[model samples]
Target: MHWITTTHIAVTWMLVGLIWVVQILVYPQFSRVAARDFPEYHFAHCFRIALIVVPQMFVEAATAVWLLHEGIRATPFLISAGLILVVWLSTAVFQAPTHIRLMRKFDASLIHHVTLTNWIRTLAWTARGFLVSFALS
Candidate 1:
């Protein structure tokens, strides 16, 4: 397999793993943060998690596009790219706003929304990762 494919698979799995952590551990933990302390906690959470998440997402998306650009026009590659788009859009439209709202205070509804809506991303990235893994093979 080519290096681009290798990078794509690696980054996709990284993102898949990260989303699961955020979904299972981090988001659920938000409920446990004290209400008074939550604003600071949420801000810190966003800032720190961004440090880990953003670059991996960027590399995954860019490398997927690069693979498509290089003429790997298979169903799986196209499907993986499409899933990446869904993951990005869900994060932007749904997840980010929920987190921003969460920063104000720990609203249980907002926390629930963030936790639930994140399934879109978590599952999407997993599918993308699985698809890309096959593409690597």
Candidate 2:
């Protein structure tokens, strides 16, 4: 297997697992945070997650692009790329706004919305991880 494809699969799997952790463990804990301290906590959450997120996203994206350019196993590569797009779009369009509201105030409604909507990303990443694993196999 090409290293690009292998790296892409690895990074894709990382995001898949990380998103699940965020969905199951992190986001659900938002409501438990004291309102007065929520903003600071939310900021740290956003800041720290971004640290892991932004670079890994780039690595995944770069590897996807490289794999596409390599012109092997195009179908799986494209599907996985499309799923990555969905994850990015959903994160920016759906989740980021919800996080913003939480940063401003710990609204349970926003927390609910974020956690629920994040399933889209979590499932998409799951599918991506499966696809890339198939590619590796």
Candidate 3:
């Protein structure tokens, strides 16, 4: 059981890491290119990303709790969870409104801001991934 739990934790951490890399490195470049060369596809791509993100967050939260309950240490897990909470708060407070406004205005400036602010989320997830890996080890 412990091995199974550890495996799940490690896999979930890897998933989070992959998501962050895609969000930070790949998605921005894709967005920029799409906006430049395929304006019509930009909004759809953004919408798809948003749709995927919402469910992934729920999965991450659930898995984090499971790992913690399965004997992952409190300090690192809680710290990582706290960081995740902060990222969500920042998204709600800063990024969501920007996205909403961008959806309304279709302004490139708003997109840039949203992408830039996304770094907060990326960093938080990356930190969480590291913590999980460490805790599992």
Q: State each model's CA lDDT, in order.
A: 0.89, 0.88, 0.67
- For lDDT, the strongest prediction is 1
| Tens-digit per-residue lDDT, 21-129, candidate 3 | 6566854664455334544454565587778677667677777677667666668777887877877897798777876665444466766777777778878877877
lDDT of 2: 0.88
| Of candidates 2 and 1, the better by TM-score | 1
Give the Cα error of residue 104 in candidate 1, in Å. 1.1
Q: List candidate 2 stretches off by more than 4 Å.
A: none
Candidate 1 local distance difference test against the native: 0.89
From the highest lDDT down, the ranking of the candidates is 1, 2, 3
Return whichever of 2 and 3 wins on lDDT.
2
What's the distance in Å from true for residue 91, model 2? 1.0
